[model samples]
Target: MGVAYSVGEVDHLYTFFVQWSPNIYRKRNNKSSSEKDMATKKTVSNSKASKKWEIITVKDSKRRLSLCSSVDSEAEEYQEEDDALPVLSDHSQLLDDHHLLKLAAHMPPRTRGYRWHLVYSTAIHGSSLKTLYRNMAGLDSPVLLVIKDVQKKVFGAFSSDPFKVSKYCYGTGETFLFSFNPDFQQYRWSGENSYFVSGNLESLQIGGGGDGFALWLDADLYHGASFSCPTFKNAPLSTHEDFIIQDVEVWTVQS
Candidate 1:
């Protein structure tokens, strides 16, 4: 969800252009007939909303790219309000502007405009897995779990659903692991198994295959492990398979 801007607050709305491929999320977020029509018309019509954004689609024939341009108006006077940067929660210890930009590029379109709310952080909350679970109790939106290891490597997972203690793993394919070893790399589902994420009192696990997990955090929230898993086909997330957690944070991806 975007920040609601009143009409008189801004004169011109700049367009937000996103380059995407149709087949990238083929199995997820299937488009409905109405959505197809909206794409064909190159506009997203929300008559009920007080502020309407017109989405213009530009196709790149050579690359078959789908470019979305969302603009409120084409007025000459440009305003910075419409293009406000994502508002990070207060005193984030893990994320910086560069990291946020890279992660946002791969995030789902619906979550583009909203601010990220810091729901849990070891820096704020105590370093306990139960405390992390308690913080995410009833959240229904997507969550980004970031971890910094003792070696100073930053990595984590993006949960399509909020983390919960469940007997059976529960999350959509949108759940994926990511690592930033100076450079950012994300691992999406490989369709090998449905074990996207599972949480228990003892541990939290993301991805599973070959008797190993893509990412695992123990109950203390101090010990962590990463391995190559069939679910995401991802390599170890840390410098080593086993790592000591320096800090952890969970941010709700508002939409």
Candidate 2:
């Protein structure tokens, strides 16, 4: 028999986005029908993930994507394998889809050329933000938070630190915000890294740790206060043009 698994694996793992889709995960979240309906309504009104995020899967060396969260899909688990095995996959085309998740054509100089590497995505094996945070906690890498407002304006922040739940902090001022305005076909990033974190952070009921990184678009900036990083000294998230976050994603930067 041919080797059960073993193909091309990246010599390096980079920062990547794990596209989380709320639509595909509710089925297994153990919510009542009515609760799910309410959640569905809330998600629809606030998130575009179901409509935009493509379904992703972690695969084996045979190029078979796993429907389960088995160890084979985890690159980190494969690091112990013998040498010269790059871990090839027939799913290489799927790799290109990372482009759709790009926050900007170019990352800030401070970012030092980091990319969003897929890790704990919601579309796979019922993963969600709760899972994302749990998986991300150990890595402690910088993260890029992307939010799509109800107005269709896509913007985000690059936090110098990984996300964590807190009632009182969002990290140091090593963060900045960016906007991807399709209407203007322009990308905008704030000028400095003065943004920080402040306020109550709850674990997400569906996914994630509900840490301060969580977004409640409807709440006032400082009240929900997951983030304190404002582009300007006075322009808190509440006053930003895209104040209402319809959907959100967190990408861990590898380098």
Candidate 3:
């Protein structure tokens, strides 16, 4: 017969090319498993937006460390109220004679050369002139009097009767009336107790039995005397003798 019809047309065409090569390799392995599930959902949404930006950068670094510890505790309470406060002058009263002749006309001229020692006859009494005018007026704390000289003679000796020819001299004259003590040791001679005249005779001058005489007159030497203490209450005055005052006279007294 023609050679069995060409061997049955080569066995049908080799079984239709072996069933179309296994259906095109199962549709290319289902399109590579749907592109590996869309690249694992874009790497799990970029790891949840990088864990929500590291939880808002750890809450803005704990609110900048609690606002820098509340600005370092209000700058240490304004440096402890600028270290406290009070400075000069403030006690009450008792440093007068035009403020001791404006503090012996602003002292500062004693290159250290003067000494006429003879201290203590109660050391200038009146309870030490109220404790040297409450310590030169510093009321008893800050002081500084360096004037080196200022005087007026005859500090003591008043017995015209106990058989002593003529004695009644109380500090003679050249302007002498001081006050400074709150412990600068002592420097009192408020003319003995009181009298800065014209300012209306300040008082205390009897001069005999009731005993009184603390005078300080000098609206420019209007006349002055009385280094008294005929018993001015507590009495004190007699830094013996070394007259001449002024050089250093710092202030503050009355502790």
The candidate scoring highest on lDDT is: 1
State which candidate, 1 or 2, has the greater TM-score.
1
TM-score for model 2?
0.39
Cα lDDT over the full model 3: 0.33
Which lDDT tens digits does candidate 2 get at residues 40-145? Answer: 8998876765677666554443354333445555654455332212222222222223323343334444544454555443234132445545656677667666
Candidate with the greatest TM-score versus the true structure: 1
Note each model's CA RMSD in angstroms. Answer: 29.3, 36.5, 22.3
Show where candidate 3 strays beyond 4 Å. 1-86, 89-212, 221-226, 234-255
lDDT of 3 by residue, 159-191 (tens): 111111122332221223333322222223234
Better of 1 and 2 by lDDT: 1
Candidate 2: Cα lDDT at 88: 25
How close to the true structure is residue 191 of candidate 3, measured as C-alpha lDDT? 40
Better of 2 and 3 by TM-score: 2
Question: Whole-model lDDT, candidate 2?
Answer: 0.43
Write model 1 residue lDDT over 58-164, tens digit each, in one string: 54442333222223333312343334346886768988876887787777777888989999999888899998999899889999999999999999999999988
**Order of candidates by lDDT, top first?**
1, 2, 3
- Give TM per candidate: 0.67, 0.39, 0.19
